[model samples]
Target: IRYSVVAGGFHEGEISCMDICIQRPIIATLSKEDSSIRVWNYDSGECELVKSYHSLQKEFQNTNQTYLQSVALHPSGFYMAVSFIDRVKVYHLMQNEIREYRSLDIKNCHSLKFSTGGQYLACID
Candidate 1:
C-alpha cells in the first residue's frame, strides 16, 4: 500500500477513500474532505493532476459538497468515473474534458464498473 497525503484542490481537508488500478501504472484517488479526483502516475509516482474541477468550483464559490463518494478507473485505462453522493461523472482521460462524457445521477453511486471492452457501464447503487 502506497500512502501519500492528498489535498483536495477546493476543499480544505483531505479525503480517505481512494482506488488504484490493479495492474498498476495508474492510480485514482478521492478524499471526502475535498471531493476532488486525482490521477497519478503509478510507475513514477508523479502527480498528473487530471481533474480538480469539482473542488476548484466549490472553492471558487466558497461552497462545499454535501457528500463525497468513491472513484474508479475503467478497465481499458482510458476513462475514469468519480462518484459523489448521488452523481457520477464519467471522464475521458486522454482529453481532460468533463463535457466529453456523460454523468449518471444515481442514489449512492459509490461503485461503478465497465465491462471488459469498456463498451458498457454499470452503476452499483
Candidate 2:
C-alpha cells in the first residue's frame, strides 16, 4: 500500500496525543502542546476542536505549561479518552451530542490506551 499526507500542522511542537477510528471513513483525534484536542475528518478536510474540561478551570487557565498529554479513541468509535496533567477523562460521541462520560484520577498521566474489548483503559506517566 502507498501513503499520502492527509493534513499538516504541529510543525513547531511535537504532537502530544493522537488516536484514530478503526472502521472505515476514518476519524482522527489529535492534541498538540496545548490542552485542546482536535477531531479531523481527513476525507472532507474538516477539523473541529475539542477542549478539555480541565482547561476551563481557573487554575488551568493560569498555567502556561498545562496541556493534554495523551489521547485514545475507543475501538467502537463511540468514545474518546484524554489524559491531562493528573486526570483522565472519557467522552461519549453521538450523532448530535457529545459529553463527558467519566473521569479517573491518575497523577501525571502521559500516555493512555483502551483495551481491544474497550472494557478497560490503561495509562502511564
* Candidate with maximal TM-score: 2
- What are the models' TM-scores? 0.65, 0.70
> Per-residue lDDT for 105 in model 2?
88
Q: Total clashes, candidate 2?
A: 0
Best by lDDT: 2
lDDT tens digits, residues 12-105, model 2? Answer: 3455557787753435455454445666656665554345444444466656656566788888878888787778889887554467899888
lDDT of 1 by residue, 1-125 (tens): 99875533333467555656655477777766555667777576565664554544464345444455677777766678777665778877773433337777677876676676667777777
Which stretches of candidate 1 lie above 4 Å from their native place? 1-14, 22-24, 53-65, 95-100
Can you give the lDDT of residue 119 in candidate 1? 75
* lDDT of candidate 1 at residue 41, scale 0 to 100: 71
Show the lowest summed lDDT stretch of 10 residues, model 1.
5-14
Clashing pairs in 1: 15-31, 15-32
